[model samples]
Target: MLDAVVVGAGPNGLTAAVELARRGHSVAVFEARDTIGGGARTEELTLPGFRHDPCSAVHPLGAGSPAFKAMPLERHGLEWLHPELPMAHPFPDGTAAVLARSVAETAASLGPRDAATYRRLVAPFQDRWDELVGDFMALPSTALPRDPVTLARFGRLALPPATWLMRRFRDDRARALFAGLVAHVIAPLGGVGTSGVGLVFALAAHAGGWPMPRGGSQAIADALAGLLREHGGTVHTGYEVKRLDDLPPARAYVFDTSPSAVARIAGLGGFYAGYRYGAAAFKIDYALDGPVPWTAKEARTAGTVQVGSSSREIAAALDAVSRYDRAPDVPFLITAQPSLVDPGRAPAGKHVFWAYGHVPHGWTGDLTDAVERQLERFAPGFRDLVLARATAGPPELAARNANYVGGDIACGAAAGLQLLLRPRLTRSPYTTPHPAVFLCSSATPPGPGVHGMSGHNAAKEVWRHLRARP
Candidate 1:
């Protein structure tokens, strides 16, 4: 009895509902879990009074999210808290490389030798960030971009292996910093298109200081849900839709669940079934008595700390995850110290730490000690600061959110052709063979992140198709 029915109340689902409702269409969203925000969910996973984001904690994409920017989330109570610095990568020699809001400051932190190259690398779109990001963040297009030359330049830099991209830099600090950014891509470092992933994050960090929600990432979910309700859309929590038959009659259906879930539910055999999931994540949330005693001063200030000694070491660890299917002895850590900016995340005189490392897909590996070991390597006495720790290996992460199939948090792989032609290489990636249904999760283009581009794009197509109806 609705114009559109969205299954899954994650960012994509909620965004689709809002988009449909905004265009004068009746919409409803159904969520399997009691709470929303698939990757963006937050909870007191550790001890009570210590709020930790179960999956996605930092928000480079969220802050620069075009879909989120279009909505009135600020009115619905969404605030982004930016640390003094966006990111830091500490080396073995008690030194650090930091990325800050200012490009010059960031380059200075990279060291004198690499400073100019760092500037040249990121400064192309620095002046035109607002103009460049919209096209970059949207799904790939055959159509001409607003800035063709800039896009071409970026593609040239982004299309290579991350190792090749960093190879230009002579200093280990600069290479390591860039490699750490690439590691967020959740693929092998030497993989083609890995450089693009790293460049995008680095550019985004400079453009929009990687921030977190004031309270927790849950605020992002709550704001989206709240906005959806304001537009006369309904959200039914604790309601799981196994198939199209389970849903109330609607003209169109958009699924924000994983490709595997859709394939099973819709009986789409080869296409969706063949969609590959990338590396998984083994996460640990800690309630700390004090801030991590980081040896490097930059690590003490930055919200994100990449705990890998150098690019070579990071590449080896990434290779281990992508090829060997085993947990690396010294895994790369992407850590968030939310308490630095948002003190309310924990109880008085306490702090919260969010961190995760890449793991082989569907491989169950214990990396708690490995994570702690790396933590201690960068921050001496890190073990002593922990009041309590909550860990989620591959199985636990996937169990908590179906979108994270095998704990691959980016939803689907962003490697090679998969980056653009996700789920399948159809002209209309969002729309299935069935015109009435569409795939609107991160499995689509513009890949993953907390941004709602997949849902936004899918809703536009669905609206266009439905509008053509008599």
Candidate 2:
């Protein structure tokens, strides 16, 4: 019998399997799809030479993840490629506020009015990324914080609504860019702990930078899978587990899936009925004849770009999707230009870009026109450069990945108290009622992003349970 059976071969699932195998535990991972990578997969969705990341492109949290840093993924063919700037938020006036590796350069872009405010905001936790991320991502029982005082200080500032934090900036540039950071998880601007969400992104850029895997996001998954195999962990693709009986008997079962899917497959009816799904994303991948023509020069070089004119506009767009259940007239967009730094992503001189805007959950309307229009606002003639395009709505996304129920990419709603306490209202969110079952999806703590900390944390609990059994 295996020591652990992990269902779903997403980053979290694969990470859990690798961790268990490294610890001398017999482990196996079963994936429903023919390949792994889940949201981290890459494909030639448009033109043959134009490779696109259907879900995640630029990874800030991924580059700074404590879980990934602790592993030797680099030795297994994982190389991070950094852009000239981590991220940029462009305005209609052809000026941009950037999140550069240097805090000073980033603060300077926000304008002189809010430069000091931005500096002061990130001062205390500036150089303590290792301790801060380790403490924030791990569960209390699983690991004690390396620096408790720093963690507490960060929590005090991060626990409030992002709206309160934005008030610190006198100008609109800083507020707008920060608002875009908070919106990354599809949460309302005023949601609790939203401040922390934005702050983390900014700090991540300063620390490790928003880097992408050299070839594409698929490298990250392939590296993890390779490391798992080296440690004697096996992965079986094209296998789906509908019930507990579908998997082989194991000492423990760790799930890297949504709460709804877990309850259904594990036969825990209504256990996750109260679990709410947030707004969906309307994503578009483009095969461009050339790079995106940005009005602001900073956006042309940055790996990630935020397309929203002002803080009010960004807030309204998020509100429209999460609260009003409708698409925003001027959808706020988050775009990435991987080909800017990684030329191998496309053919010679050609580029690949992707943009997505938030929409109501289960929304089926075509958002291509709206998304392109938003892009045209910041990057004029954006449509002229597109050679081909592939679009995915909530239905298409759900069809591709079951965990993205209603196209909520973060897996579950990142709102209210649920933002802090997720999957359930328990101290140990990884554990379920069944002693042998555990969940480690993005639906759990430290919420969403490409970071494998969710799986890292879950493995700790699974190994402990396995140790206790014998």
Candidate 3:
């Protein structure tokens, strides 16, 4: 009998296992796949030497995670490489808006007209970026935030819809850039609480600058796994836990999976039927013959690039994601060019790029051509350099990881109600009716991101439950 049985070996599950093991509790992790690393996994998806992150590549959440900061991942073989620019949003014209590490520089890039507005909106929180992240990332608390006043100010701006937030900017450059950042929310741009998504990403770029693991996101997962083993946790890959009976006896079971999957795997019944899931994605990874020839100079140096023309267009496209079942024409695309900064990711002089656009939930349309068109719109002749490509639509994503149900990468939507009480409205979202069971996936609070807070947070509760037992 073990102290805990962690079902899944993703970043969340590994973090849970590590946390329990370090506290002198025996732990075991079971992964369905031959390999682990869930959304953080990297592989040769296209051609040999062209490594691609299957789901998540750029890590604003992972890099800015307080939980990851506490770990010795760096010593355990994790190196984060910072780009000159964290992100770039390109327009139809031969220009781009950049999110640099420095707020002044980022504002300046937007031009003097919108510079002050950008500074005013972002700079106020820039100096307190650490405090802001600590407050946002920590488990929900009734007590005031570390900096309540600062949080209140942030909340005023973040609580509004992203479309409303765009009103603050005078020019398309700044507005478009912000819209791109918020599009990660997977919610309609005009929907409530969308600005928070945009604000967090911008704050994160300034807090620590968006950095990717040296080799790939896999490095972060590998390091967490290594740390777990060092703490005496057992990891068994190629072993899927279907029913709770499949797992060894333990005081507690932490499930790093969707609320829907957990109910089936552990016989907990069903999640709230009213649980509203938002959009899914149509993703593509390419093995390029050469660097993407972007007309925008800033995009050449950016690690993650948001490919779209303007805020208005991005908002409309994203709106279709929530209201319709079909993918939008000229969709907003989020792209990451890893080989531009890390040579280990591709063959010499070659590059590996990944991009994805929002689609309706469980969308099965082949969006390969549509996504390629969007890419070529900004970086003309970009298709010429594509030696090979791999794509994952909704069905494909769901098949790979059960958590990414219907290709919804966020696991659960970040809407008005779901954002506050994810996976359902329970006093303890992680805790199930069964005392020994807990949901540690991104489905829990502090929502989506590679940040291990969900796992770390759940483990604290599990640890308490274990300590109470004889």
Candidate 4:
């Protein structure tokens, strides 16, 4: 029996396996797909020599993650490339809200009142970015920063609804940019615990500057996989463990999958009994040729672009998502043209644009036309840029990685009562009720993103248990 069997070679799984291997344990990772890197993958879909990131494109978490930082991805062919402007919020009127590498520049562009408010909001979190980041990324039970400064920093931003906070800012541009980042919470914009999503990302944009991998997100995943292999860990692809019996016997089994998959694979077995399953899934992916061709000049410079015109527009779109329905006509979309930052992504002048909008749980709608039409609203003649498009509806996404049940990329809901209690509020978030079984995927707390803290924390927990064993 191997010391550990990580089921899913995603960032979290690979991180767990690497830690276990480093700790002198025999570890093996089983991936459902032939290719590793669950969400952080690049493929040549639109055209030859055009590498597009399938799921997650721009990674703010990747730049700020403690686990990934400790891994030193820079040493392993991960070129951290930042845009002159971190992100841009282009208006229908052709103006833009650009988030520069410097927080002052981004805030100042918002006018005096917004500038002061923006600084005040993010200032407290600035000094403690590292701790706040860790607390946000770790599996809940990992201690929140004991330092008063950091604690205050966390509370100031996390303690309000995003809608409530947006009202405090005077300028529309600044509010929209912050709202765009917060919309990633995957919950209703004004909903509980949703505000923290805004602060976390806003702070990250200011601190680490939201760097992207030069080639693609796959580089980071590939580096993690290479590290796992270097540490004597084996990753088996095309092996889907439908049941516990299907997996190779190992002392510990860490699943990088959703709660539903966990219940099915392990037969509930008193392991995931208490958790409810009502996660909101989505169908998301975008394909485009050349640039977005936004009327706003700054949009061409931003790595991330927020499409929703107003904060209310985004809030309403999110409100639709909460009702388990698709947003009307123009949905809130987080679109990124990675080719802008990494020229290697496209051929000569041609580029690839990626975007995903909020949707209902288990939604089966083919959103290709809906999404394309929406993009055309912002970037005129966008259809002309579409060389090809790939639509991973909820079911297809769920089928690809059981972790993303019903195409909920988060593996579970990111907010609400379960935000901190996800996968439960135990001292060790990864350990399950079943003996030596663990949940290290985004399904666990600090839910979702390319941050490898979930896996890192899980490995540490299991290491302690293994060490204590006679």
Candidate 5:
């Protein structure tokens, strides 16, 4: 019998399989879709020559992930292409605040009023990314922190609501940029640990940069699958597992899926009934004739751009979705222009751009007009460059990937205590009531993003359980 069986071939699932195989365990993965990549996949959704990342485009956390760093994914054809600037937050006045690789440049963009504040905020954890990320991503039961002191210091600042954290900045520019970061996870600015979400993104940019794969986001997944095969791990695609009996018998079963999916498939009925899904995303992929025309020059070169006029506006937009259960009139957009740095994503001078705004969970209304309007605010005449566009609402997103229940892309809600103690309150978040079953989806700790740490952490538990049985 196989040592482990991983269901779902998402980054987390594939990473778990690779980790088990590396440890000399026999492993197999079954995927519902014909191809892998889950949220990390790429396709020609708009025009034939314009390759778009339906979900994730720019990856900041992926570049800085300890789990990915431990693997030799680079040897398997994964190449990261960095943009001129990691990210930029543009205003209506055509000036922008940027998250550059250099902290100084980023601080300078915030202007003298809050430059020192921004510098001081990130100073405590500077140059300690390896230890910080390792400790931050791993649970206490799975791994001991390499640097406990730094981790504690970071937690103290990161545990508060982003609204409180924003008070530290004197100017609106600094607050607006930081607010945009917190909104990445679709959490309200007032939510606990929202500060950490923003801080993590900023620090990640400074440490490793927000990068895209040389070709598309799919390269990350293909590399993981290739490495798994090399290690004797097998992957079976187009094989959906509706129940436990559908999968081959194994010593352990790791699910890289939502909590509800695990409960349903594994027959642990109502185990995850309390798990709450949050706001959904209305995403658009554009096959553009040319690059996005940005009023701020920094946005034209940056890999990611935040389109919100002020901190108040960003907060209201998030509040509208997370609390009011309605689409905001002016949605705060998080956009990426991968073709800016990776020309291979499109044909000749053409470009592929992605943008998404938060909406109420299970929202079915069209967000194309609202999304394009927001883009036009920061990137004037943006609609003029679009050759074709593909839009996905909550229903379409959930249909494409089951993990995205109700279109909540972070997998589960990233708010309250759930933000840190996810899936449940237990320290062993990876383990379920059934001793042999484990979960490694983004629904677990360290929350969402393309980082494979969730799978990396889950594999540690599966191997330990396997060893204990024998």
Candidate 6:
């Protein structure tokens, strides 16, 4: 028996456990896989000595996140590495768009019209970013500060479609590049609320400069696990907590698993007639001999690349995924080549690339060659550099991480109805109707990416809840 049991060792679960242990509570974490760091773990997937981050590799959100910043994983043997530049968006015609740390430099690279618009749109938040971000990141139902200016700005930024924002850009390259970045939210680019997703990630890129954890994202998770150990916390890996009754007795339990897992663990107790499902999903990883040769040289600067040609192109791809159809020709892709920045990731001159494209939920399309073909369309000879590849369709993805149920990475849909009334409209997003049982995974607010804020936030609520009882 312990004060708490966290049922996952991902960044979020570790974050929740660490927060509890720091507050002097006994906490235990259980992970299904022998390895911790769900999604953040690094492994030699391709070949000997070639380390690839199986899930998320780049960290704009992780680096800029206040949650991770406070954790100070760097103190525990983790180093956050920033490339000379953040990301490069290259086009088919040999031109590239680069997002740099310096606003002036990024703009200068874009030239006058785009440079001014980019700066103008993003610069106002510089002095007020933290204040503004706090408001935007808050759950839509949460009462915000009574600042009219902040509210107005947040509404304007969040409510608009990403395509609307792109219309402001005069340069075609600039529009395509920014649209690609925003599509990381897994939403249609031209759809409403897409701007909010784009704004947060873009702001983080310039603010934190998009970093990679040295060695791999596992470094961050290892640091959290080490910290928990130092604090008398225990983690049991290779333990899949299928039933709440099976877990060791604890005053409280927080689930870092997916929404569907929560339902399963809760069982047929009148709590889950309203579960969500993903109709389409697929994941593909490639092991390239070198970097993705971009048609435009500047596109190589970015650690993450968005692969839709334009806003319309991005929207259609997303729509296809939503409709559970294999998008024709080019699919929307979120790519991260950490080896471009971290040479230790692969053998000398041999690079490891990681990418996952949107696919029909449960669709078994092997897009390894399709992904390469799209890359080749933008970067000639891209196919020649491929050394090996691996892929996980919906079933395989669900098999790999139960939290990624139906291969829905955000744990659930990130847009529309799900975002507003996530899992249910309880007072605390972490807790459900079930007592001492909590959902701390990415399924909660401020969803997705490698940031462990949801778990940290949920841990706080659960800690208070348990402390207030008995």
Worst 10 residues of 3 by lDDT: 135-144
lDDT of 4 by residue, 74-183 (tens): 66788889887888888888888777767788777777778888888777777778877776565354655546567665766676777888888877877787788877
What lDDT does model 3 reach? 0.87
Cα lDDT, all candidates? 0.86, 0.92, 0.87, 0.77, 0.93, 0.76
lDDT of 3 at 191: 72
**Clash list (residue pairs), candidate 6:** 87-302, 88-299, 88-302, 279-361, 280-360, 280-361, 281-360, 281-361
Q: Can you give the lDDT of residue 339 in candidate 6?
A: 81
In candidate 2, which residue pairs clash?
Answer: none
**Model 2 poorest ten-residue lDDT run:** 136-145
List RMSD in Å for every model shown: 1.3, 0.8, 1.4, 2.1, 0.8, 2.2
The residue-by-residue lDDT of candidate 3 on 199-266, one tens digit each, is 88998998888888988999988999999989899889999778999999999999999887788877
Candidate 2, 57-102: lDDT as tens digits? 8889897788788789998989999999999999999999999999
Better candidate by TM-score, 2 or 3: 2
In the range 92-114, model 1's lDDT, one tens digit per residue, is 78988888888888899888899
Candidate 5 colliding pairs: none
Off by over 4 Å in 1: 142-144
RMSD of 1: 1.3
lDDT of 2 at 263: 90
Residue 199 Cα positional deviation in candidate 6, in Å, after optimal superposition = 0.6
lDDT string, candidate 6, 19-95, tens digits: 89988899999998999999788888778878888778888888766567777677788888888778776666676
